[model samples]
Every structure is written in C-alpha cells, then in structure tokens.
Target: MSEAYTGGCACGAIRYEKAGAPIAALHCQCRQCQQRSGTGHASYVVLDRRDDLIVRGELQTWPVAGDSGNVKHNAFCPICGSSVFVTFEAMPEMIAIHVGSLDDPSCFHPGMVTYAARAQQWDRVGPGLKSFAEMPPG
Candidate 1:
C-alpha cells in the first residue's frame, strides 16, 4: 500500500490526511492561477478520489468558473484564510489540494507548468520540466 499523505493549514484550523500519492501535481501559471497564488504560478496536488481524503475543519468556499468553463471551487479555512482543497466540476473524482497548505510542503514536486504563454516573464519557473502555452491536450 502507498503511504498516507498528511497536511494542515498554517493555523492548524484545517487538517487533512489522505491515502495514495497524487495522480498529477502541476504548477499552473494561468492568469487566474497567478492571482490566486499571488505569484507567477499556483501549485496543485491532484488526488484520485475525494473519499480517500479525510479533512477536519469548517471550511468555506467561493466557487468560480475556470477558463475551461468548469465550476472551480476554491476552498479555504474560514478562520485563517489559508487556501486548502478544491474540486472542479470537470473532474468529479479528484480533489486538488494546495501544496502550500501542506504541513510539510516539501513533498510537493511540480511535474509541469501550464499556461506558460501567459506566465510572467519576470517570474520564471526556472529550468527542467515540461512547459505548455496552455494545458497540453491530455
């Protein structure tokens, strides 16, 4: 069996534990991602199933439609305002967690960067890994 992954919010108001490694972990530099992350890119941990996730907290969400026109739910801790997990209407079986929200964030290793065409030139993601002008057709 795969090791269970665990993490929590900065204030510990929101804690999460899950089994299975991420199916896809990517850094997105889309305009929406930049604004959300307050940087050039937003990191995400895409897990297999919401059932595999165990979270503790009274979270709040502000749902927004993504460029793909999917309902993207932005969930965060109600107390500390730390962005946590999210579920997109396009991908029902997955829960994407913010890497920064992890108690031990070092586990996050970005495999790719999407929307490089919109990425800020001043804020480079540096070398290595594949980059795409837009989310590459999977």
Candidate 2:
C-alpha cells in the first residue's frame, strides 16, 4: 500500500493511522467477536508492527480472555462505544484493527475466516477463502 491506512471512531473521539500494509486480514466468527460486533463476525487487519500504529484521543479499554486463554485488550471510543482495535498479550508486537473502523473500509480484503466452528449457520463467510474451525496454526 502506498499510503497509510487511516480511520477513527464513530463519534470521532478516536483516530489512528497505520503506516504499513496489513500482515494478515481475516474474519473472526468467535463468540466474543460476534458479541462485540453485534454481527456474525468481526473483520480485522493485523499489523505486524505495533509501533507503526499512531493514535490520537483517549480510548477506553477492557481486558478479556481469548479462546487461547491469553489476555486480549479491547479498545474503543468512550464517547461512541465504537470498538476500534485489539491487542493480544501473547503477541505484543502485533495490533489488530477493526476493518469497519477504516476510513475506507473497502481497502480491506479478508483472506480467511477463523473460528468457523462458532459461526452461526445463517451468517456464512464469503466463498473462496481459507477457513479454519478454530484459530489458524501459527
């Protein structure tokens, strides 16, 4: 990607810029992702370098245990309750940004679907992508 990826929260209380292409992009259908997104799945872009992400404005955060039993930090806009990103305790160098929060969401292209076992039958993922019943192997 030539330009930096930029995005913000619904109420504009939080904004960010990521300076590199995503390392991986996928749709997570895990129960927690579903609950947070209020949808069947949550789409995200994984940035290889956490330091490449620059944020402005205060954000509220919540800690939750992931399926792997690792702590994950969910960050959101306190004003709009918009979930922005997540950081994993097991992978501190990576940052996952919610695709929907992107200024140009169309720039995102999910290459895979994860947590397929928990996915609702009515909320199927797109065709022609790699899928895993649970988390993909590293």
Candidate 3:
C-alpha cells in the first residue's frame, strides 16, 4: 500500500482522501477536457478501487457527453467551482481525480498522454511519455 492521498477544493468546501496509490496518471487533450478545464488539457489520476475513495462534502456534477458518446460526470465544488473528480459511464468501477486538486500536486507524475490528436501545438505535452491519439484499446 502506498501513502494516502489527500486534497480538496480551493475554498476547502470539499475534501477527499484515497487510501491507496493511483493506478494510472495521464493528461487528456480531448475537446471536452479542454473546455471544462479552460486550458489545453486536463490531468487526471485513476483509482481502480472506488471503495478506497472517501469524499466529504457535497459535489455538483455536470454530465459531459464524451466524443465516444459515453457520459462522464464531471464533479466539482459548487461553491468555489473547482473541478475535482469524475465518474465515467463507460467505466463505472474507476474514479478519475483531477491531479490539480491534490494537496501536493508535485507528487503527480503523468506517464501517459491521451487524445493527442486534439492537442494544441502550443500546449504539447513533454516528450518520451506514452501517448495515444485517443483512449488506448483495452
């Protein structure tokens, strides 16, 4: 077991803890991610076990229609409007947390880049990382 991970919204209205380490960490450059993050991409860490997550405080979610036609619930703090975590209709067993929401974000090391096809040339991810134009095949 890895060290516990903890973080919350910018205003501290929402808090979360994951009992174990992340299974995967990556940056997504999909259109929806860019729009939601108001940037070129969104960084996320996936926790395979939903039970390891403990979220305290109310979260407001807006369902996003993915390019694949799957629905992803973008969870955020309603008060401070901070994007936090997300749940996907395509993968119900996992939770994707926004790496920016981490108390110590420097601890995150993204190993993959997704949706490279939509990435902006000005916002290119660093080289040598595993990358895919879209979600990798299962």
Candidate 4:
C-alpha cells in the first residue's frame, strides 16, 4: 500500500493525514494564490475524498470567491497564520492541501500549472508541465 500523506501547520497547531494518493498536484498562479503565499504561485495536492482524511486542531477559514465564480474556503492555522488547505463550496468532497504544509514536500509532483495567464515573469514554471490560462475543465 502507498504510504499515507501527512502534514500540519508551521506552529504545530493543526495537522492532517490522508490515506490514499492525491487526485492531482498543481501550481496556481491566480492573484489570490499569489497574495496568500506572498509569492508568484501556490502549490497544492488535491485529494479526491475528504471522508478518510484525518485532521487535528482548529483551522480558521476565510471565504473567497474563486476565479471560477465558486466560493472557496481557505483554511489556515489561526495561531501561525499558515495557510494549510482549501475546500470548495461546489466540491465538498474534495480538498486541496498546500504543498508547503506537507511533512515531505518533495512528495509533490506537479502535473500542471493553473492560472498561467496570471503567472508572473519572475516565477516561471518548468516548460515540460502542461499549463492552462485558467482552471481546466475536468
């Protein structure tokens, strides 16, 4: 069996573990991502099911309208202010965890770049990965 994915907030106030593989991994260059990460982009690993994922500690969430017009709940550690994960109002069963929050961030293998149209020149993504101007259709 594949090893579980584990991670938490920088302050140890929040933690999470997922039992299965990720659904997708990508770097988002949307304006909100840039602002939240204080960088050109944010990396995430999308999980297909939220039911089996175990989480500990309180996460403060802020609601924001996504570029797709859907509401996204951005969850973070209230104490450390470290963004941890995001949940979609439209896709409640799915969850996207920040790659930086992972215990072993090297496990992230980004397959694509989202919001490439908003990507900054200084934060260029690798040329080999597929990129989309906006969120791609599933």
Clashing pairs in 3: none
Per-model TM-score, in order, reads 0.92, 0.96, 0.94, 0.95
Q: Give lDDT tens digits, candidate 2, residues 1-138.
A: 645888999989899998777788999999999999998999998887777788999989999998789999999999999999999989999889999999999988899999999999889887889999999999
Q: Quote model 3's TM-score.
A: 0.94
Residue 112 displacement (Å), model 3:
0.8
Once superposed on the true structure, which residue ranges of model 3 sit more than 4 Å away at CA? none
In angstroms, give how far residue 33 of model 2 lies from its true place: 0.3
Clashing pairs in 1: none
Candidate 1 TM-score over all chains jointly = 0.92
Local distance difference test, per candidate? 0.83, 0.91, 0.89, 0.92
Give the alpha carbon lDDT tens digit for every residue of 71-124 in model 4.
999999999999999999999999999999999999899999999999999999
TM-score ranking from best to worst?
2, 4, 3, 1
- CA lDDT for candidate 3: 0.89
Lowest lDDT sum, 10 consecutive residues, model 1, at: 1-10
Best to worst by lDDT, what's the order?
4, 2, 3, 1
Q: Per-prediction count of colliding residue pairs?
A: 0, 0, 0, 0
